[model samples]
Target: MTVEYTDCITLSEETAELAEKELRENEATRRHGLQQVRDWIVKNPRIVHCRDDENFLLRFLRAKKFSAPMAEEALERYLLLRQSWAAAFNNMDCTLPNMKHLIDAGYLFAAPGRDKYGRRWIIARPGVFDPHKFTNEDMCRIHGLVYETLLEDSESQVRGFVHFADGAGVSFPHITLFTPKEAVRIVKNGERTLPMRHKQVYGINVHPSLKYVLDFGLSLISDKIRKRVKIYSSMEEASDEIDTNMLPKEYGGVIPMSEMIEKFKEELMAMRAKLLSHDEMKVRLEMFSEGARVGSVTALKQGSALTCGGRTLDTTLCGSFRKLEVD
Candidate 1:
């Protein structure tokens, strides 16, 4: 049975129509797309212990607009990155003390409902996490847990999602949490490696230092994503573009941010088994070399390098890294 978490809203009929029109998804396409990707995964030796369930595979297909080839590539990258960046991606235990704290504090979470465009909202209060108390990986894991769980919803896969960063209380200390390499890696993964489709990013009352970081991130992402980034002087100004009621009361909505946070924590715990199961979804990189066959095409050739998180690593050495490689 598919497990569900609270506060993660379901798809409306209007949104379902939008998904069919925008994502090219329907009953027919879903079946054909699922089969194509499933066949490729079974044939590909490098992919082991990965869940090939219909719900899981559909995320890639929906994100790629039912294109099997693109979905296959995304699936490969998703598993491969999780294998390489085990520290940040693995052992996603939400019950841990720090992880629980971040959840209770509302550091990052999915809003209770969809926006006017049908896209879900993931609000981030970076200031809630004391830079001194948590490491960059901790922040990454929290986001990874939330998004991974969110992506399980079929509507999120099709409608995609937006990010809202409440920059109130953000300061230089939060800015210091990430080194240059770390910052670049996070942006790269969010844009390139992850399987979900990212629609837009909204930030209100952003800190000057964090804006510098945001600027740096802009340089790393594609022009399409760059154009979707919207920063406002205040939440009121942001409401012009975003529906106010969809936002938390702190941001001029009817719902309280604390209420959403508590619900998100319950959602996280509800999906705990599924989240922890990711520890077993690893890639056997030996099967990814030059001669290996992924369906009809070669996965990678000898001496060919894989560019991950803006860093290039020789394909032969990709499996050796047990953690995100720091340069």
Candidate 2:
């Protein structure tokens, strides 16, 4: 009885710390949620065998609004999806030369400050996007850095986030040249894998000519996300959802977008070395005895499943990739 009491006290303390440290949920909810997810994690032999057991489980639980079953299914799909895209994902390095070119092109940046709900805001200006200059794979690497650096905050995980996908500068040529399939892959990757609350997506400054691209992209998202999406024909209308005071001057703020982006560039410049170091750590985990291994990326055609490092995943791939030669 004394030992059981001590165990209970220890569990309570750990749960309290979890609440304070990461989830920001109340202690009781944290304890219950963690236990539920933990048990769910243990039951899934695949999850138990994966290196992502530590963070992925909790991330999916919270992302799924703490439904253990849903989170489990989500985790399984996420693992299977990432494993399939070896060319795109294997040895992903944020500091790659291509990634730096995209950053310098002003493709992606975290708009400084939080939204009214204390949520982080990021604006991805794919308007300046040039297919000849980059590839779907490069965008994926940029997203890796975005999630690792900006969206990794425990608070952002709890409060959720909003993105201003400004496609004002994107022409019909840009859409056609890049291919809608690759576009879907880049957009949907966040939906399928990123571990955070995605509350709102504002399609600001969308050009009328590229409405087809918008329509096609919207078709890929579920009704839940579809309803949360608000498309604005003009920047003024989109401002209602964001605090303009927090945005760059281009979007109506005190500072210029160029200045904010330059500051972000400085931060990026410093991370080049760190991101490079991570490139060497990628491994075909299934070949390793103790390393956690998941199945590979399935082909998009709904054909046979793909296998990597002795693990096989039977899932349909949702996106297509183009083989482009980089300059």
Candidate 2 has which clashing residue pairs, if any? 83-296, 83-297, 84-296, 84-297
lDDT of 2 by residue, 179-269 (tens): 5555665566567555667778777878777777678888877788889888888888877766677677877888888787778766565
TM-score of 2: 0.68
Among these predicted structures, which one has the highest TM-score? 1
lDDT of each prediction vs. the true structure? 0.73, 0.58
> Which runs in model 2 stand beyond 4 Å of their true positions?
1-24, 35-56, 177-189, 262-327
lDDT, candidate 1, 1-327, per-residue tens: 222222333455766677679888766787678777777666554567788887788778877788776677667767876766677777788888888899888888988877767678998988788888898779878889999889877767877898888888888887778777667666765775577778888889886656776787789888988899889988778887877777789888899988988877777888889988878886776544322211112222223444445565544323212222222
User: Which whole-number lDDT from 0 to 100 does residue 254 have in model 1?
Assistant: 91
Instruction: Please give the TM-score that candidate 1 achieves against the real structure.
Output: 0.81
